[model samples]
Structures are given as structure tokens and as C-alpha cells.
Target: MTAITKGAPRAFVLLRSRRRLDLLDPDPEAWTDEDLAGGLSRTMRWGGASQWEHPLSVAQHSLTVLAIREADGALTAGEGLRELLHDATEFMLGWDCITPLKAQLGEPFRALEARLQTAIDARYRLPRWTPEDYALHKRADRLAAASEAMHVVGWSRVEMRKTLGIAETPLVHDPLSPCAFAPWEPWPPRVAERLFLERFHALDHAHRSELRKLEPELRSSLVLTGAEHAAS
Candidate 1:
């Protein structure tokens, strides 16, 4: 989606689905998983300010968070799925700001994001965020941020914790080492899109009973296509 600024010439985005999404006032019906995946595959996180050659996309970051939650082994199947989709809204809406900048943007920015998130949650039949889920999400998000900071952005642990408000004790563990937390390298845009969709399907299959409750059209639309799976 194009940025919604006061005098920007382009005010709407035309998705591959031929749906025109209004930047200032997005219509939920105009969105689709295909559109989201494509957009997020291109949207850069940290406003594209990472040390890596390719900027970390929100889709990649989201998959890492779900992986962290799954590795933690405390959340249920539904909770794990929720973790995978916590940033789905960011997929449709362009990723433009970080946590600290969010405060500067104030309530308007937050309210808009929340509105998009609510629509996404309803479409997927995702349960409302319970207090526990919120806390866990925060922890997982911070853990990912710290990992990205230390590894991708090349920040020290002390700088990450002190500046980014990351948790002191790491929550995400290294898959290879099993003794430390490390960041996954940012994938190229195409790889990131495929992996994001692959993870989405994997989580959906693991939690189908919970996810199938969504509207049939939504459920079908959300499923990864044969081509996507093949590519991933």
C-alpha cells in the first residue's frame, strides 16, 4: 500500500486481485491473503534500516516470532497460529514505523492499525487477545527484536536491551546451538514470501480444527496454493 500522506498523488493501491485498496480508509473486503503475502514480501521492517543486504520483511519477522513461541512449548496450537498472524495487518498496511516512532504518531496511528487488525482477526476467526496471549506476544516480539538487533543489525546485547527495551533474558533459543538465541538471516523477497506462506499453511494444518471455524471462503482463500508450496 502506498503511504497515506496529506498531499500524496497516489491514494490507493491496485492489488493483483484487482481490488483497489484505499490507503486512508482501507476496506477489509478489498484485502486477500494473496495481496497480503505479496505486500509483506516487499515491506521492509525497521524502515529498511538493517545491516543485512536484504532488509528484514515483516513476513520473515512474523515467522520467527511463531517459531520462538513454538520452541517455547507453552502455547497451544491456536496460540501458535495466532503468533504466526499477529502482524498480518502489517502485511496489508505498509510497514513504516517502529515501536518508539509509534508513540510519536500517537493514537491515530494505533487506532488505524487496530482497526485493520480487528478485521484480520475476524476474517481468520482468530480469538481475541487474552492477557496471557498479549504478554506472550510482547515477549516473543521483543525476543525477535533483540535477536535481530544483535545479529542482523549488529548491535550488542547491552545496547539492544537498554535501547530497544528488549527482555534481559532471551526467550528465543538457537535451533543449531540450543544454548543461545540467534537471528535468522533475512531471506530474499521471493524466498521470504514462499516461506511465509509455507509457515502459514503448516500452522493452519496443525490447528485446522480451530482455524476451520472461519468462513469457508476465507479458509479456502487462506490456504497456500499448489504453486506456492512447490516454490517454497
Candidate 2:
């Protein structure tokens, strides 16, 4: 990675929409699903330090988080969309900091992340996170973290709970079923990107209509299935 000179003109990333986006001062209008999917597919969680052969990408992690949220309870389309893109701005920023590290980075980092997140929220038409929303999101996130640490990074459950501050052990795995919190496996980046976009449209009001309008094949992919359909 080439270091940006301190006094130099800032660099811009050209999105698939042919929009030039300033990362330091991003415009919500400059990003799209294609940009998010593509960027996030390539950004790995834990900075690609997992014990697995392939590192878990943030795109796959986002999908997992959304799945956990959906499994939790009945959610409105907007709520589900919020869970899906909770870390959406990280895709554009190209890195995810751990909670401790983020605090250490101080106010400047927080400000930048806040601005980026606000822009991302605007782009997706997601409402601001309510206190209830934060509590819900945090629970699901910690559960996912515990599962990921245990499965992908080979951390012991006790270690995860005590060392990583993950208190949710019940979600570590389901002894009764193979579906829930089974294990973390890295999805192929291309597959992750496509599925992330599919999930986004399935939850996004405008995009859901657009998918039905523009592509029938996409409609099949977007429709709620099995338990989800029943639950909905």
C-alpha cells in the first residue's frame, strides 16, 4: 500500500458506478451495492489472521451476522437491512479495528468512522441506531464474535468469554442442529459478493422493486424462503 503524502491532494477510488469517491470525505451518492460487495469481499476480518486456510472476509462475516440477527426474532425489512449493513462503511474504509484498538485510536478515528457510517446509513436509507437497536446489534455481534473466535481462530470457549469479553456462550453451537452457529468457513469472495448483494436487495425496499422490475432471475434469489418466508 502506497502511503499518502501528508500535504498531497487526497486520492479517490472510482466505483463501478463510474463515480469518483473521496475516502477522506466520502459522498453517500458515490457508493453503490457493486462497490460495497466488491470492496467488502476483499477485506478480511481480524486482518486475515484466522487459523483457517482461507481468512474470513468481512463480506462473509456481514452475511453471518445478518443470519444470526434473522434467527433471533421477527424483524421488519428495515431492521434486517440495518443488521446486514451494520459494518457497511468498513467496506469502503478497507479495514476493521477491534473494539479495544478503536478506543485507543481516539476521537479522530471515531469522528471519521461516524461520518462514514452516517453516509452509509444515508446511502441505504437506514435509520439511526436507537438504544434498543444498539443493544440488539451488540448481542448478535458478540455472539457471532464468540462463534468466529472459537471456530475460525481455534480459541477455547472460556478464552472467548473471558479473554475476548464475549459473554454469549449459548450461541457457540447447536448440538441439536447443524444449521446454527456451526462453524466459520470462508466463502469464496465472488460468492460472498453476490450473496451480500442478493441479501441487500431482499431487504431494501427500492432495490427489491428494482430487482423485480429489471431481472426475473434476481427475483427468485431475493424471495424469502422456507423458515424466513414462513416467519415473514
Best by lDDT: 2
Q: What is the lDDT of residue 46 in candidate 2?
A: 77
> Tens digit of lDDT per residue, candidate 1, span 109-153?
898788777777766666678897788788878887777776667
lDDT of 2 by residue, 1-232 (tens): 3455788766477766776777777778877778888888888887687776677778777777777777878877777888888888787778878889998999989988888888887777675688987898888777777777777777787887788777777455521121322356666677678878887877897544543575766555567455577797
- Candidate 1 overall lDDT versus native: 0.72
In order, candidate lDDTs are: 0.72, 0.75
Cα error, candidate 1, residue 125 (Å):
1.0
Native-to-model Cα distance after best TM-score fit, residue 114 in candidate 1, in Å:
1.4
**Model 2, TM vs. native:** 0.77
Off by over 4 Å in 2: 1-11, 16-18, 170-182, 206-232
What residue pairs are clashing in model 2? none
* RMSD in Å for all candidates: 10.7, 10.6
